[model samples]
Target: MAHKLTRLVPVFAVDDIERLCAFYEKSLGFVQDFRYGEPTYYVGLVKDVVEIHLISTSSPNARQPWGSGYLSLLVDQVDDLYRRLKGFDAEIVVLPDEGITAYAIL
Candidate 1:
């Protein structure tokens, strides 16, 4: 039998854990699942069964260590989610194009 893949959870390194957590909780409706660290350097969030992990980094003012990556979320209503996010001040790089099935934010 072929190997079976289960759920996927993406981890992102952020400068500020609290700020990112706030964004995910308030903006995306994710709930805080767990946290760690003295100054709170690690965090986990969940929406439904999907999990997102975040790690705080205090690196100098340089380029991110991770070259490039992005997360793609498939929602029931993409247009509604897009409209809801429009009220906030997030950088939307890719809007739903003719060939694209989802919008992207950076």
Candidate 2:
């Protein structure tokens, strides 16, 4: 018998979940699924099959860094997704063959 894994939801640290959730919804096409806290400090988002969670770092454990992340998301239709993302204000760059190969090698 073999164990199985289900889903991998990445939690993004943020000082303001409202703003971050808005960005994810607007820029990345993710929809808000649920939230937690009085002012909604923690929120969950879903885009197609992929889900993302955002947690606020404004608590007593404020040592957590805010708004700093590096993620490589694997998605279908890379070119179309790239074009859609390019319309946003985010910095978009196309990786050449060497750059992509580097990821593959890793």
Candidate 3:
């Protein structure tokens, strides 16, 4: 017998879970899947087959150091997504090239 892997969901620690979830919805086209806590200390977002989880924390060190981690999303239209990200004022650390793209919501 062999085990099968179905999915991988990355959880992010943020100072403002509500704000970050909103950004993922409005900016990246992700929909709200679920949320925990009255003040929304945790959230789950889904876009296509991908899912992301966010947890709120006031600690300044909640998130990993810059460049220490990243999330990669594969979109059908790389150029279109890049343009949309730029319009949304996302923190794009790398420009799209050769059918590949990368950006951040920070």
Candidate 4:
């Protein structure tokens, strides 16, 4: 059978899933799509394209490492995102160097 790649949603194992969900919603402008058990399990949507799943650290399959990877988001205005994130305490792992090109490591 031919392997076909569909969509990729990063599942983040967080100590506090609810707090993480709130951070994404408040900081990254993501809307709550669906949540289970008071945000213990949650799916958030941003721009109707990107999806982020937040899972609690206590979940059954929670302790697995995400493996080394990077997801790059291409935006016309990185500065705007940078400013917005700064207000929400999102760590700027990489700062844009003179080209208005920056990255948010999550």
- Maximum-lDDT candidate: 1
Off by over 4 Å in 4: 1-3, 42-46, 66-70
Model 4 clashing-pair count: 0
* Candidate numbers, best lDDT first, in rank order: 1, 3, 4, 2
Runs in model 2 deviating more than 4 A are 1-4, 60-69, 93-106
My TM-score estimates for the predictions, one after another, are 0.82, 0.68, 0.80, 0.77
Ranking by TM-score: 1, 3, 4, 2
lDDT (tens digit, per residue) of candidate 2 on 1-106: 8978898888777777887787779877889899888867678999888888888887553356555656576776766656665676555554436435212100
- Decide which is better by lDDT, 2 or 3: 3
In candidate 3, residue 85 scores what lDDT?
A: 76
lDDT of 1 by residue, 38-103 (tens): 778778899987899988776332246647778877788788788777867778888888867688
lDDT of 3 by residue, 18-37 (tens): 77887899988899999877
- What TM-score would candidate 3 get against the native? 0.80
- The stretch of ten residues in a row with the least summed lDDT in candidate 4 is 38-47
Clashing pairs in 3: none
- Which 10 consecutive residues of model 3 have the lowest summed lDDT? 97-106
- In model 4, residue pairs whose N, Cα or C atoms come closer than 3 Å (at least 3 residues apart or on different chains), thus clashing, are none
Give the winner by TM-score. Answer: 1
Cα lDDT of all candidates, in order?
0.81, 0.70, 0.78, 0.73
For model 1, where is the 10-residue window of minimal lDDT? Answer: 57-66
lDDT of 4 by residue, 1-106 (tens): 9999898887777788877777778876788887776535545556458887777877776667857556576676778888988888877788888775867655
